[model samples]
Target chain A: MSDQQQSGGAAVASSPPVGETLMEVTGVSKVFGGLVAVNDVNFIVPRKAIVSLIGPNGAGKTTFFNCLTGLYRPTTGRVNFDGTDITAKRPDIVTQAGIARTFQNIKLFRTMTATENVEVGMHPRLRSRVTGMILRTPFVRREEKAARERAREILSSVGLKRMDELAMNLPYGDQRRLEIARALASEPKLLLLDEPTAGMNPQESEELRTLMERLRTEQDISILLIEHDMKVVMNVSDHITVLDHGEKIAEGSPQEVRQNPRVIEAYLGSQA
Target chain B: MRFLASLRSGRDTVTGMIPGWVLAVVLIVFAVIFPYLVGSGSFLDASTQTLAYVIMALGLNIVVGFAGLLDLGYVAFYAIGAFVIGWFGSQQFPDVNGGKGIHILASDRATFQPKLSGGRLDIAGIHINFFIVLFIAMAITALWGVLLGAPTLRLRGDYLAIVTLAFGEIVPRVFENSTSGLFGIGSTDFSHGRQGITPIDKINLPWSHDLLYSDANLKPAYWVALGMVFFTIFVNRRLRDSRLGRAWIAVREDEVAAASMGINLVRTKLWAYAIGAAFGGFAGVFLGTYNNTVNVDQFEFGFSVFILAMVIVGGMGNIWGVIVGAVALSMMNRYGLPQLNSLSEPLGFDVTSISFGIFGFFLLIMMVLRPEGLIPSGRRRLELREAEIEGSEDTGAVGDMSQMYEVRQ
Candidate 1:
């Protein structure tokens, strides 16, 4: 395993950095009794770059994302985002600091329309006061118009323009796209997509891969993705971080990490 | 030509316009001319009282309907509002110096005194005009709403419901027991327990002074209540389309998701509770003046349940639904039962309680048949159907559901 890692490790040494340093996690660890979920993990993701965190089951990819997103306080680590320490901030506070994320399970307001769902994401940006809202003053009306326009644009960008329909009525693929559009509506500099292509068909996965690339290139939004699909991750990710047993075992370009024996064993059986 | 063109275009859509504006105009005109056409003063008076309830239901709709909060103790705010007017407007507060000083100045020339008379405490001082008391009552009630909302905003669902219920219960008891040394006021014989404060100041206007039925005139109070109903409707419509309204709906739909979107859940919830409570308070004050009395029994749990039923039956989260529900329910409670009893007597049956029993049965059927009410909010109707479809479609997909949960877990 060590020999296979050293052979593939040299190829990743000189890859170009596409994204800006949007998030830097240093010495992060999480322990529950005798089990360590995430152990001394260190990583850096650049702005406008599509990065993937891949690993086998119980590899702590979700836990690390949770800690960074402020869903859970890290046992020990400092997570700095855009040069601000946001390790212990609440999820809402973290979102206000220009970071947004989608959950592994879609957590959309299922009862609301797709447009309304997108409009909710724009809540922090709207400036109408309660009195103004209740009174339906010019300020509130103007803000509403602007927010609706923005939501429309976001929905279009995610290829969901025709689906002004209620969120629950959307087909599965469209629902996933709506979720991304909703997250994008928050106007985050960094977007964390956890298992974006978890249950999609191959065609849907391919479409998502293309969408991820386009978002990084056009929207100028950095992405930190957690994916189990090796093909999609290999194709879309500019850089890859491989985790096994709650620790980063390999980190580099797609070609380099692909041939690493430790990564192979983590995915395939040891005998193979 | 333009009108004809627009009419043609309107007919092309599946969801055609129902000419709601014209309907509203007709309703308003009828409401204005009803008392004269009806000819019976008692019937007119009950009609006006029913309108007040309609306004209150609309206010409650914003909180329970739009925000999806189950507030079981909404009557507390109403009680506070009524008592504010009763205590101040009637000059009923006893003098502080062992009943020897002038505690309040009255609008009319009435002598001051404090004594136990006819199983009640008699306190005499300056009584304020009903209108002034009404304004003060609304303001005080709004303030009390803020007080209740401040501590309980973080609670959600059943917990919030329970806390609000307790607050509602506590408020009336606090007022009823104010003069019983429970609040450390030294048993000054004011707010005499359970019996409640009586001789509440009658609401009157200057123009009605020379008119017949002038003193304790129900018409003046009717107009005021009508004005409030319009004002409430106007405010509620504005709020529903505002950013705050969106925040409330967002919180209602998904608090965690709303918060993640940078909506402050605490603030949004508090605003909904406070605004709703303020309306309840205003209604309470108006009710106090209308009856010319205030009693602990008047703002009981039953009233709260009645208001809840009004909101529920009208349609949770729909403004128009609440108005319709309120008016219909009020009419049923006030007039429907009596009419039913009259009809029953002619048929040789004792059916005095038939109307309420029928109402309860209708509610039970509605809960099973259309949980969203007769006219549910657009969002509610859509979600309910979606849930039904999903439930039927996923009968054998339990494994998939568990798998999704596992992935989420």
Candidate 2:
């Protein structure tokens, strides 16, 4: 197959229409003994939209993200992703089912090269088995070459340089971008980013915000962002869900959620 | 400062001067002609044994080094491999199919049994070809590897090491005691008890009528071992660069991140164990055939540690490093200690008696001075020095949340 066909066909540039639910989390509650991490959280990510889940510390934003991504089995809930119930599936199965995620702390394969980290993300998609790998059959060789090329393309697309550098050796901001590049390598329908811009400078965060927009509009991917940076959340989110101590207290467009009294109270305190 | 500079660029000077493939070719050519150059039968025999150890060390490197699974009982696979040859390549089983031995693709020499039924020559045991038995050993050991690895899926670090250690210990004892077959269920004798199976069929190609080199020549055995080592190296390099290899590394790096990336941790790790054990078995068959014995005494815990030391000392996760480690350690045990015996004789001491103690000291020094090994993989080196490098670079990094936590406290 031609290089264009390999990288282009899978991810067509046509943006998915809005209002179609890419992921629907209904009545999803996670109970760790008596402590309720995520309590009956009903959430939806529209197609090709950058949806934000924002809250104060201990508000279960990351827990809710984990439930959506199949990292944690919800105590009571159903997570339907793109018309399939992916509730309580293994993380690998969830990724195979077209949902990919980045961690709160950068979890790039530190020992591996930047390209290798991305290639690993392409694991679920590649079909070369052990025999083929050992023999280096033409099919396996072709597949491996294509995966490397695509990894390079994804890394470049994410605005990352130094493709040969170790993931741990890359600058902190580049590490964050590499994480997204890796997540993108899985060809996920829904992308979950946990604090993607946590330690980035304002300039880097701005670039990431633009990249998130491009990912939605150009790649037809839906993003579920759990971020503390209100500027990024308010700027990129098509819709926002605000949680306070495990319960969803507010939900609407950025402006509406920003103006909500309960959202302000959650962020500030009861007196506010 | 000069010492540190040399340490950093020492490996690079040789590697950078010659292309990697060229270096590999030179090594291969040297290895091919080594038996002739050595000439002495004892030295060739020791070299062959060292090559077998190389295969085993490379095998263990797969699980312990690449996949970061500490396997303390790698000798279990070795025991299984040796026994495979003992069962299939020996006259351990006398009564099979009414005493007409099951011989499949075996050499004519191996098929010839004593005269029976009016002076008619007949085979009386299962005599499979050496090459076929090698594969069988690998397959059986791989299956056992998966089975043993299944229970340790949830285990990590010390717990995983302990479980594998138990398995390693149990297999050899079982073979030693299973004189009346497993659990005394059948009349089939698994092992010939403590005496072990000896005088196993010699190695021969199915097509070649003449017996392959044995104790008298030893060159053929050395060549065979060298060939297996080459195969093991080829397989190891391929697996290290393949998709499954990447998955193994990812799992080793961070299980949660790897799982999130859609890598099946269970299967990836099991593949490491199975492939690792298969190589162990591959070498085991060769060692058994070459030594002309499959004794339970050979599969001891110390042997497992011996192989592990090769991996650790040579450099874990580096194929060439492991091979060097195996050769160095095996030669030290074989030639170095014996050579040292002459010096120690007048002093009324033996170096071989305190070999393990010396080895322990060497390991402790390696751990303290160069924990990654004498030659570390590039990735491992980076990991070992991550703190040093990171501290120097990326000072612009923010989010020192630990300080915040301390303030709150």
Task: Judging by lDDT against the true structure, name the best candidate.
Answer: 2
Q: Estimate each model's TM-score.
A: 0.83, 0.92
Candidate 2 per-residue C-alpha lDDT over A61-175 given as tens digits, one digit per residue, 9 for 90 to 100: 8878777766778889999988989998888899999999898877789988899999999999999999999999999999999999999999999998899998877999999
Q: What is the TM-score of chain A in candidate 1?
A: 0.91
Q: Model 1, B1-409: lDDT tens per residue? A: 4764465366545235557687778878877766668764777788778877886787678778877777888888888888877677565665643553232323222222233355233355335555566667667777777788777775656898899899889988888878756467575555767888776655545333222233344565566778888888888888887777777888776665677677776677777877887788778777876776788888877677778888888788888778878888888888777777777787887564454456677678777767777567878877667667789655544453432221110
Candidate 1 regions with alpha-carbon error over 4 angstroms: A1-20, A27-40, A199-204, B1-17, B94-135, B150-157, B180-190, B204-217, B338-360, B391-409
lDDT of 2 by residue, B376-403 (tens): 7877777668745677443432233221
To one decimal, what is the Cα RMSD in angstroms of model 1 from the true structure?
A: 6.6
Which candidate comes out best when scored by DockQ? 1
Note each model's CA RMSD in angstroms.
6.6, 8.2
CA-RMSD of model 2: 8.2
